[model samples]
Target: MGKFDDLPETRRRGLERMEQVYGFDMTDGTGDFFRYTADHLFADIWERPGLSDRDRRLLLIGLLSGSGGADVLGIQVPAALAAGELDAEELREIVIFLSHYAGWPNGARINSIVENAVAQASRPPK
Candidate 1:
């Protein structure tokens, strides 16, 4: 059996949800940080009601932009696109809109990441 085969229901649900959100398998992650991420962050926080996944994605994009979370955005942008949570046009517009508030440098970085993600998505898999 795999390492997480006997995980509790919450952790199991979190791992499932993580794959749904990120568009990739999450079971390969290990250690305490990954444990808490699946157990709490994904299970409790992301599963909370009142906000759709798309809503959360948009909110997270803004927060990431403001905080200069380019690295995280590198992950999030592609996931958002793959999940159909945000399209390239909407993403480009977000960068334009956020440029005024999040600062030009940060916005520019996000714009580049968004474009790259879009480009990568359009390419046929090797």
Candidate 2:
């Protein structure tokens, strides 16, 4: 089972249906959004023409975590962990940065959500 397997049937069907509708020759976790973000978004968009992926990842972590995207950040956190790119302190720092700029309430909310997301991994691993 892959990461998508952990999701419910409804979401699985939804993503799959979207794939079928778009006529993309890909599986549930291999659609354009996922592929583009993982490959192009990271390798190309983040990699830039010269900037490092580390910098890009930090920027992305900040961008996602800072702008009230705890939900999205929650998802990416796992991806970052899977890729061995994120550390606890760094993740905490992203939340801290959000608190400064994105407002404390939003950042705190994200922190709670992030805590839950991190706990999710320890819960059976899907």
Total clashing pairs for each candidate: 0, 0
TM-score, structure 2 vs. true: 0.55
Task: Assess the local accuracy of residue 26 in candidate 1 as a C-alpha lDDT between 0 and 100.
Answer: 75
Per-residue CA lDDT of candidate 2, range 26-76, in tens? 344556776554444433444346755456556766787657776666656
lDDT of 1 by residue, 1-126 (tens): 654568888888788888888888777467999888998999899999999999999999999999999998998999999999999999999999999999999999999999999999999999
Best candidate, TM-score-wise? 1
Candidate 2 clashing pairs, residues 3+ apart or interchain = none
Query: In candidate 2, residue 104 scores what lDDT?
Result: 86
Which candidate wins on lDDT? 1
Steric clash pairs (candidate 1): none
TM-score of each: 0.91, 0.55
Looking at model 1, which ten-residue stretch has the lowest summed lDDT?
Answer: 1-10
